[model samples]
Target: MNFKQLGLSDDLIKILNKSGIADPTPIQKQSIPQIIDGKDVIAEAATGTGKTLAFLLPLLENINPKSNEIQALILTPTRELAIQITNEANKLKEFNDISILPVYGGKDIASQLKKLNNNIHLIIATPGRLLDHLERKTIDLSKLKTFILDEADQMLLMGFKNEVESIISKMPRKKQILCFSATIDSSVKKLAYRYMKNPIEVFIKQNDIALDAIEQDIVETTDRKKRDALCKVLDEDNPFMAIIFCRTKRRVDELEAVLHTRKYNCEKLHSDIPQNKRERIMKSFRNAEIQYLIATDVAARGLDINGITHIYNYDIPESVESYIHRIGRTGRAGESGYTCMFIDPKNIKDVNEIEDVIGFKIRRRNVEI
Candidate 1:
């Protein structure tokens, strides 16, 4: 249905039309009604399915402009996600004139503290930073009406259970809670059972690798041949943007150095870099200023971007789910993409598991070095 038919304000509808969001996505169509009606919801939808806007729009539509205190709080798993959510929230300028702030670690807390005095309608934050604000009394959640946990599964994976629990305990008892995820891990399910009140569960089809619009292949190789093989593939494909997934920080560093030595526009992302640098790296990558990004799983998890042409698994992932998550970087928003995995003889089972979940065999590409 049209956004106008969804009971959205005229101003919001106009904004959506201008932004080319005329029709609501399935999740939006289903959940917006419940969210606007002030219901706790447990929605399971994959990435790029408009989960952010699904929740943000209703929150913006239901905001109490009369109140100066924080009214809605969104807890995300990563700093990048927190920033992305806050950016999207700012696009609701047609609906309200309230502040939307993003709070996360590795940035200056003083700046965020300065923003606390404003009329913030929505606060999108990471768990650790939110708990910090709660402890310092810098954030007033007593008037909170809606609380959202975006990417609940990712948060649980990052070991934020205690912090998330503490943050939840501080919110008002009468608030409407919403939790959205790609996959509802057991911890997330348990959290919903404990905190949500008669929540409506909405599960869309999980995004599998085979169902994605990405072509997959494996390059069987030895450790010494992997670098040369990757270089050959890069020369052949000449991708506009690509991410090379390494298994360790050393590998990421070495790969970056080697690519730099070869004059490839590349950068490294890992836990070792400070947050500011990471932000800059991502900004460059998003703007197409950098063509290649080398990263580990921890750094690359939850990265949401568009127009990624290729994803190279420099090392085979031990967890089968990770293979899905990695290739998921490409073939987004119904666009066709490609993924190449460098596999050793011993890692055949890992590749097989990925194929089993995706329900298809990845075509093999042989490159004799």
Candidate 2:
């Protein structure tokens, strides 16, 4: 279904059309109606499923542009996501005329304070920085109309349970709440039920998490020779754009260093990288200025840019969910893509688990190093 059928404003629709986004995604189709009708919604959608627009459309459409007080507050797990959401919001800002601000650490607080004084309608912020504003009374939430928890599972995983609960407590008792998560476990459900009233649940299951458009292969190699195997694959298939998934920040760093010596345009992303630098790197990667982005799972959330044609598992993931999550980055929006996993001998069971979930065996691509 198109966004117009979903009852979006002409201004929003026009903006989306110019950007070649005419249809509403599965998550958008289910959640938009309930959200626009002013219902609290709990949506089970993955990062690549357009979960951001599911909330953004209704949130922006419902916002009274004339109101000066904060109407909507979106809490994210990391500053990068807050910035990403703000970027998405800004794309439609010209039609909406709504002032959107992102509040996070590492950014100049004084600049944020200056923007906070303006007629801001939406505040996309992280929990810790938002809590700091709450405690200092620098931000007001008493008149909040809509509260959104983006990446609910990620927030709680990052140990923001108490902080999230405290932030919710400070909001008005009668406000619309929206929760979007990759996997809605009990904790996310508990948080939603505690604050929302008879919320509608939009569970959009991705039956084909294996992603048919993305070609998959297993590169049999030892841990010590995995880098050589990866280089062989890179030289053989020069991808348009790719995300190289590593298990840890150290792996990402080491991989970046290795690629740099090989003269590959690459960057590393992890929590330790300053938020500003991470945002810059993300911008560069999205613009295709960087050929490869080596990042851990946590840092790679919300990085759903188009044109990502390949995903490389430099480090094999331990779970089916993570395996799908990594590959899902590519083959997005119905585009053909490719993925290769560097599987050491000991990690065969991990491959088996993923194969069991996807109901097929991944083709093996051998590279003798």
lDDT of 1 by residue, 27-73 (tens): 88888889999999999876656778889888899988777888999
Q: Which ten residues in a row have the lowest lDDT in candidate 2?
A: 204-213
Expressed as tens digits, the lDDT of each residue in 189-287 for candidate 2 is 998898889999999876734388889999988998989899999989899889999999898999899999999989999999987788889999989
* TM-scores of the candidates in the order shown: 0.93, 0.97
Question: What is the C-alpha local distance difference test score of each model?
Answer: 0.85, 0.90
On the 0 to 100 scale, the lDDT of residue 199 in model 2 is 95
Count of backbone clashes, every candidate in sequence: 0, 0
Where does candidate 2 stray beyond 4 Å? 208-210
Candidate 1 local Cα displacement, residue 57, angstroms: 1.6
lDDT of 1: 0.85
Q: In candidate 1, what residue range of length 10 has the lowest lDDT sum?
A: 203-212
